[model samples]
Target: MNIELVPERQYQVFNSVAGRHHHHQPIWQNIKNLLKSCFGTQSDSRLLNRDGSLIDINRLRQNINDKQQSYKKRHITWPYLLNIYSPSMTNSDKKIYQNRARIRYNRLKRTWQERVSQGDSFYVTLADTILKDVRRTDRHIKFFKKKKQILFNIMMTYSVYHPNPGYSQGMTDMLTPIVYVFIDESMSYFAFCSLMNRYMSSLFDQDQIEINRRIRLFNLILHSIDNELWNKINVNEENYLYVYRWLLLDCKREFYRFNHVLRVLELVWINSISPFVISQSITNYRSLFTIFICISILQEDRQIIFSYSNDEDLHKYFFSSSSSSRSHRSTKRILQQAQINYSNYILSQK
Candidate 1:
């Protein structure tokens, strides 16, 4: 169970059971596939057969055309503005729609640029982290680097292995930190793969298993720790959902203290003692403490959170709370309580 120390082959078997078809591949191959998928041609069919033949091209085209017509009628497009200038639509409406489109596209472009830049940073930082850890004198660092390389090769070969779930922005986000910490590309890759295999089913599809798992654990812990607050939150049906941002990024987006985040991760790893801790915590009672910890953090910043009615304020609060000492203390208390409950629960189970 000490995955960090076990032989590579043992975990290789565990990985296979977790549904990975490849544990090794060339770096160039993964990069090639990623490029192809991003820029290559794609199918236009709305539906497809088992073998991938188009099932409804005409209907799909018709649907697209209908939507286009609807946009025209609603004065929501460039053509609609042309009509307005030609006296078909009023000047006021024309200016409004054009401005809206310009504003929307500008915003979209800004977001795209940011994600692209972040993705680039993530890739470089991850690669550097892996290489740096490998060069360190620690013996664990060396072995970990070997394993990480295997995983890296596999990821590079992702297109040939799991074509349907090829590289995603989130994948890079998940991989970067592991590579930095572990230094072995293969080990980091497998660790990340192990994690993704266990939790990412909800990511690419509509299956709510992962989300439900979080909600259930959140409810269980809230019910255990503070029934009064639990009842209040439940009445609003917003316990786990309120904490969605934290879960989505593994608390990277929420916690300001890197050391604190690592401690929480260690607690989670120890509590569930499962590699699939993120998702498993959703169903395990011990995960309740994790949610409680989150609530405690937020409650300490109640004024900051509730004071903000819009995104700008929320963003400001997020940065502000990251460095706040008061909130950090509450987080530590929550973790301590979680440990007490976890110990009590284990004793009772035995």
Candidate 2:
């Protein structure tokens, strides 16, 4: 193998598997967040404008708004997980799929094949939604590939609807799973765009104010938990660059390990709509506290982290540890303990 040559086939194989697995957590979390945000007392109390006007957070949740609910139920069944996979499941399955990309690609190919065979013209609307590269830029062309045309179209529609945001690099990653699930490309685009409008304010911002706000929130959490760690990292000075992308994109780039990524995503999704319990004191904070809870979970593994300085070692530990019974149990326990103390300290002042 040429050392410098791009492993296009291997890349696609890994991405397909990773994408499919990653898809589940976000969908489940989004649904849970939608429901909890609507029904949960904590979140309902917090969703108000600066003027104290109520925000209809529930409007963002999923429901049987139309015929789509029935359709959603059909595709989201459990058995479909096994049914979707190729027959030749093996240890080297990813390699086989490199020769022929499995699952999602097969699904996409099948859908495309059916549309072509039926002579369906439904794809035209989807094509129109794709934004023209008016500048005809090479970067745009490279970023938006043929495989991602549908994703691009949907994101383009999202951009138009949220004219302030227009388009951004991270938007495609957020929307891809939505496009894959809806099957009816056009409807999927609209739904995903709508869903995004609720939570994606930072990416489309002129000043990236929301990103800054979240970073502040994280800093507050770090101060509350481990003042020493906070000072050591010097977040204001940009020492913890690793977490910058994670917080900004909400962990999309860092979470190649499917299960752990899904776990974190699910936690956020469930918490999203619930009103953030702001601290009553000047010391109070928001979502970043939970991020500290996550970091504390990793604290137990800090020795292992230090032991293996390479990226692969860290990846292996994060992935392997997430699936281990003891580690998962420990993470849950730490989260519960931290939340109780943090909540008491915050709520007592009010």
Candidate 3:
């Protein structure tokens, strides 16, 4: 069977099973209600405000307090910093407790060291690279150092937890935005893992099967959309390596703001719309939507790309273009163009 058919088959099986399990409706409905309540029915205008000014600290604090109260009332197990910081040891018992804790910490440290030694060298190199680029001069030096440490810890913990795909070069880039948003290392780690498993698991596959599959799918889509441009590039699947980082990191490095990346990711996560409308009924094509997004991005640069006469020029263009942050489009525009292109492509197929 074609590898591409697997996702479609899985979707079909899932839908069939879901149809039979009508009893699950209430559970799903409850989950939807919970999410709506947690996130609110309408988007918060304060967060969405694009004005170039400092955030209203008082409003932010109140929003956080409201969320905490809601979570507490609903008995949601939110991790509190106090739980990690507060010690139960009394003045008299402090010595004994300290000794026990030191012993436990030593054992864990030794185990962690052993695991780190056994981890992939490539991941270690990537982790080190991530740490080097983790901070910016705009932030306080000490605060930036602390954030780098938190990021390092999160990457190490995730690598240990997922030993098979231990770590990949782009994994750190993927986690950076998540860690920045969550702030708390533990929460960020959990969110990173969830995202990896849900949307980015393939990118880390040892066999490179999933990444290659997506690349091929992307090539086909590009060809279908504009064979002239596709042929002009004069590259095969291997030459399309330029797109690997984009897909793997989900354009995290491309976008200027982390919030913009988050917005794009949220839409990608939804995966309700299909790139090819003709094939929409056959499969949701959820996994291929990112490729469609890439196509949309490429569309923005099509004219510039067409100007290149040779592969070297094109390769250089791609390499130098990373810092061309001005070219990055708004999340809304990217999403709209992607949808429009996908719909047109689907119609063309018909």
Candidate 4:
């Protein structure tokens, strides 16, 4: 029983069972945060255990149900939960994952360092846009203020890889909380890639249809979760601008402290298991859950949203510099409401 092992079998078993039971969610979430500290939201692909057994991709597919259904029904005091042979591992395992993550991080940095030493950004065309966003993104945060160039380069690198739309305005807003969380540029970039490629690609899509598609979906989400607000508001192009801003910035402006923003961002990133692997078969978890998050913000500020006559006024209502307005809104309330909204939408779909 070497505790320092990254057993693929145990990880698979943990994946199959971890968050299924509601009672386990509190501890499970803590474990997940600890893992994120080591892995930076990137799924560790070293899927071999002490016995040299390989990972089974088929078993991983059972997760959508495990995530949705397990919380619906709680099974307490099972042998699986109590057995010493369960999926739980040790701090040494954390050290192993952390070490590998550093290796990956350093390797990526070396490659970038070589290119940087040669004065090659490879994002020459897109640098201007990325730079402008980086300059003004988060000046209040000391790290963001100091590492402006690094943030600029990360977005530039992303542009070089994903040249479709190159770069957009609010993309930096999406990157801010991620960089803050990972606190390492290389891991942050990879984590950012996982997040964007997951369900957020649409918001940056060129045809502009996908962005609109998300707006339409938002209306459906709003209708489902808060019909009162939905009925009160007119669903038109004018209001779509509001939703567009929300999608682009990922509701970062909704919260006062950046920690609250990190919580929501991690909420979207945590449910995602295969961070590096993009699969069409897996349901779009980020897409659906993100909508619920937006709705939660809107629901929290329902009175403010309705009290204002125009979008301009409502925009100022939430985004105003007065931190008090945003501070009162609880992160727990936002998350709990989001889950409730998601559950309602899921039940309605069935």
RMSD of each candidate? 23.4, 20.4, 19.8, 13.0
Per-residue lDDT of candidate 1, residues 45-81 (tens digit): 2333333333543443334323322222222221211
Please write out the lDDT profile of model 3 over residues 45-118, one tens digit for every residue: 44223221213434433444333223222111111111211223233453454456456544543565565578
lDDT by residue for model 2 (274-315), tens = 354454423223244445554555454445556764555554
**Which candidate order results from sorting by TM-score in descending order?**
4, 3, 2, 1
Instruction: Flag regions of model 4 displaced more than 4 Å.
Output: 1-125, 235-237, 272-283, 309-312, 315-325
Which candidate has the top score in TM-score? 4
Q: Which ten residues in a row have the lowest lDDT in candidate 1?
A: 75-84
Candidate 1: segments with Cα more than 4 A from true spot: 1-160, 163-169, 198-205, 231-240, 274-289, 295-331, 344-350
Which residue window of length 10 is worst by lDDT in model 2?
77-86
Name the candidate, 1 or 3, with the larger TM-score value: 3
Best-fitting candidate, scored by lDDT: 4
**Cα misplacement distance, residue 120 of candidate 2 (Å):** 28
